[model samples]
Target: MKLTQIDKVYGKKHVLKNVTLEFPAGKITVMVGPSGSGKSTILRSLNLLVTPESGQYDFNGHQIDFSQKLSSKEKLAIRRETGMVFQDYNLFPHKTVLNNVIEGPTQVLKMGRKQASELARELLAKVGMADYGDVYPNELSGGQAQRVAIARALAMKPQYLLLDEPTSALDPELELSVLKVLLQLAHEKQSMVLITHNMAFAKQIADKIVFIEEGQVIYDGGPEEFFSADNPNGRIKNFIASMTMENLR
Candidate 1:
């Protein structure tokens, strides 16, 4: 997927300023930056949850103009191609884990109940949540809930998985379970765009890293180059160092 000259504004604040980015197929691209830097906004734009004020969004063979109002068909097409996972596990509290996972498939994709159940169970097992299929969202720990959320997103078989701080809501110990599932997904070559503050975790699994600040991309490169002296931008180095300091404290 590719985005070019994307721009967004919220009142007096210009959140995304002429942002351009590319996510290569079957790779993990991690977005990192300070809070309110528009990292999440970019992810939201990709999922069409927040349309850009003006720009081009390209996915598969579709090149959508954000400058114009998209038809309902166009919005649905973009959503069908991308799956989004949020910081909070937006599960139906009344539904069992399995039910939550299968809902999209049965409702949106029009899959039969048996098939959707089968697929949901398979995904649950993949995320190490098989045993919790009968459990309610409120009964599971934060980590387990997020794992189920991941499984739910995967049920759609989207072309690109977009995540906004999937581990941010969890404690340090709980973060591991969700990160492990993400690592497994990375190993399986699932194309993804992740917005995260966990720099260490991001460095571990990212195939490419994009650093943004104050609504503009400052650095875009491989992990090795991003961490090494090859990165001529001193700002990223300082940012990483500051994050490291915070982690130590």
Candidate 2:
């Protein structure tokens, strides 16, 4: 996906300002920034969850005209191609883990119940939660809940996955489990735009790192370039320092 001159605002507050970047297809790209820096806003805009005031978003060779209003059906179609995994595991409280994973395909995509169940089982196994299919979200730990959320998103077979701080809510041991799943997905070449504070994971899995500050991208480059002290951008250095402190803490 390619974004150009993207702008977004809430009343008088501009959350994103004329941001431009390209996400390489079939590769993991991580976006890092402090809170309220527009990192999540950028991801939400791609799926039209947050409409941009002005911008061009091109996906798979089709340019999205922000100025033109799309019908509900059209917007749903775009969202179907992009699945978002939220920081909070947004599972239905009444649904079992298996049902949560299968709900989207069976409802939205109109897949047969049996087919959806089979697919859900496969994805649950992929995320190392095969045995928890019958459990409810509340019965699982935060990491396991997030794994089910990932499986739920994958049920739609999205071309692009947007992950917002996938590990933020987990304990350290649980965080490792979730990150391991993500690393496996990265190796499988899933196209993803991840908003993360984990610099180590970004360095290991991301093809490119985009650093946003106060609604603007201050640095976009390979992980090597981003970590090198020879880089002249003070903003990047400061960002790295903050990230390091967060990790150390």
Candidate 3:
């Protein structure tokens, strides 16, 4: 997926400024930055949660011009190609885990109950939540809820998965559980764009690292070169160092 010359504005505030990014298929690209730096906005824009004011977006044979208003069919097509997971898991409170997972496939995709239920169970099992299918979302822990959320997103079989702070609400130990699942997905060559403050996690799993600050991208490169001694991007280096120190505290 590629986005070119993207720009976003909220009244007088410029949230994203001329942003261009490439998300290589079958690899993980991580976006990290201080809060409110437009990282989530970029992720949201990819799936059109928040449309950019101007840009070119290309994904899986569909190309969109942000300058023009998209028809309903165009919007649905774009959404069908991408799946998004939010920070809070965003599960339906009254729905059982099985129901939540099957809702997308049965409703939007017009899948039959038996097939969607079978897929939902398989996905829940994949995420280690097979036994919790009948339970409500409020009954699960943060990590468990997030896993269910992931399963729900994967049920759509989207071309790409977009995650915003997937594990931010969990404790360090709990975060590892979610991270382990994500690492497994990475190994399976799932294409994803992740936004997180976990520098260590980014270093461990990111195929490409993107650093955004003040509504602009400051660094975009491979992990090895990004942390190498010879690299001269002081802002990113300093940011990583500070995050590391905080993690230790």
TM-score of each: 0.97, 0.96, 0.97
Question: What TM-score does model 1 achieve against the real structure?
Answer: 0.97
How many residue pairs clash per model? 0, 0, 0
Q: What is the C-alpha RMSD of each candidate to the true structure, in Å?
A: 1.4, 1.6, 1.4
Candidate 3 displacement at residue 118 in angstroms: 0.6
Pairs with backbone N, CA or C atoms under 3 Å apart (clashes), candidate 1: none
Native-to-model Cα distance after best TM-score fit, residue 24 in candidate 3, in Å: 0.6
Q: Write the per-residue lDDT of candidate 1 for residues 128-228, one digit (tens) a residue.
A: 99899899999999999999999999999999999999999999999998999999999999999998888789889999999999999998889998878
Off by over 4 Å in 1: 246-249
- How far residue 145's Cα lies from its native spot in candidate 3, in Å, is 0.3
Model 2 TM-score, 2 decimals: 0.96
Relative to the true structure, how large is the alpha-carbon lDDT of every model?
0.93, 0.90, 0.92
Residue 68's lDDT in candidate 1: 95
